[model samples]
Target: MPEFNEKAMHQFNQGLIKEFRENGGKAVSGPFVNAPLLLLTTTGAKSGKPFTTPLVYTKDGDRIVIIASKGGFPTNPAWFHNLKAHPTTTIELGKEKFQAKATITKDPERQRLFDAQAKVMPTFNDYQKATTRQIPVIVLERI
Candidate 1:
């Protein structure tokens, strides 16, 4: 894995976000190709400004699930906190965009969903083992 630097990751994510938007939510190249991804726009907790994050997601019935793994960093991602403060947000999946409400999943269900996602993207398992803190799993229910 590459070195984990916040600044570098931010720049990289900016590039991915741009590509995702320009390509109708599809990542034309890079590791994200053939991978499930969505643009989640949230209200910043402190800044109160709108922030958008590119995330890999899985669908469960009518809900979309995202993990706050932060690539197994010690702390949760800012987007996670943002959504916690303002549960209502917007999600862009493929060519479709819609509003949704975010909720943190509880235990049992959280673990189950995490395992299901790990099965699809094995790197998630490695991410879990990389950090001491238990990553959070968030569900986005369309409004």
Candidate 2:
């Protein structure tokens, strides 16, 4: 596993968000190649601090969807933890931004949402096969 450097990761991700917003559709994280995504700005579940994570997304009407795969790691991503504590968040899509609510997909419904999203993000299937944990699909509705 890679060492976790909170500061470095924050700087790098913030740069990505700035670029994504400034460059319109021309700029995006490396993850965007296989899936449409947005930056989810959230508050920490424990520390109560703010953080942002780049997440693969799908659109359902006016809502944005994200999955907490952590590349199939055993643990959920920090962003997912944070969003659980603070379900309300911010979504940055290209040059736009909006308030949103982070809702974890539930039970049988999760299967459908997960399959639908996986169609757009085949890498998610790879993530699933890599770990035993259940990857969560977090749906963010515009608020």
Candidate 3:
């Protein structure tokens, strides 16, 4: 695998964020085009700063679910840690934005949600197989 470049990733994320906002939370082009996505804004765990990340999401009832796959990397994503420290967050879906509370799911529910998303995205299955740590499944409920 190629080495991870934090700066490059940040730049890419900045562009995606701009596109998502300008297009009403839709990615009209780029790798995430047409992919179900949402903007998750979480308070930084250590920085005490607000950080926004564009993530692919799935829905369960009235809640939104996101996986911290990090492309099956060894460690969880930073946003995951941020949510753990501060569960209250902001979610931008489609053309709407709202406050939400993040809940990390466990066991059967986690498995169920992960499987459901993998069926829709397929790549999640591969992401799971790539690492030993069980990926975290989080539910964001409107607040």
Candidate 4:
């Protein structure tokens, strides 16, 4: 396995975010092609600036679910911290955009949602094993 490069990952994320926004939230090519993805805009934890991240998501009965897997990195993704500092955020799924509140799922519910998403993208299971810290499963409830 290769070492995780935060700088490279940030650049890649920026490219995907630009593509997703330009193409009406659809990624024309790249790893997320044909995958269910969303653009989450959250306030920076410390900077108070808006930061948008393109993430794979799974729908859960009127809510959007995302994982803080960070590609199995030891630390949770920055967006997760941003959401923690500012729970109210925005999400764009395809051409639809909506306001949402982020909440971290707990316990068995987290595991259940994680499993549901893992079924769709099995790499999530691998992500959990790659890191010791429990990855958070966050629900974006439409506001």
Worst 10 residues of 1 by lDDT: 1-10
Off by over 4 Å in 2: 1-12, 25-35
Better of 3 and 4 by TM-score: 3
Question: What is the Cα-based lDDT of residue 87 in candidate 1?
Answer: 97
| Model 3 alpha-carbon miss at residue 49, Å | 0.2
Give all candidate RMSDs, comma-separated: 1.4, 2.6, 0.9, 1.1
By how many angstroms RMSD does model 2 differ from the true structure?
2.6
How many residue pairs clash (N, CA or C atoms closer than 3 angstroms) in each of the candidate models, in the order given?
0, 0, 0, 0
* Per-residue error (Å), model 3, residue 102: 0.2
| Better by lDDT, candidate 3 or 2 | 3
Better of 1 and 2 by TM-score: 1
Which residue pairs clash within candidate 1?
A: none
lDDT of 2 by residue, 26-110 (tens): 3444644434557788998888887877666787767677788877777888898888889999888876888988889897877
Error at 85, model 2, angstroms: 0.6
- List, residue by residue over 26-100, the lDDT tens digit for candidate 1: 998999998999999999999999988899998888889999999987889999999989999999999899999
N/CA/C clash count, model 4: 0
Worst 10 residues of 4 by lDDT: 1-10
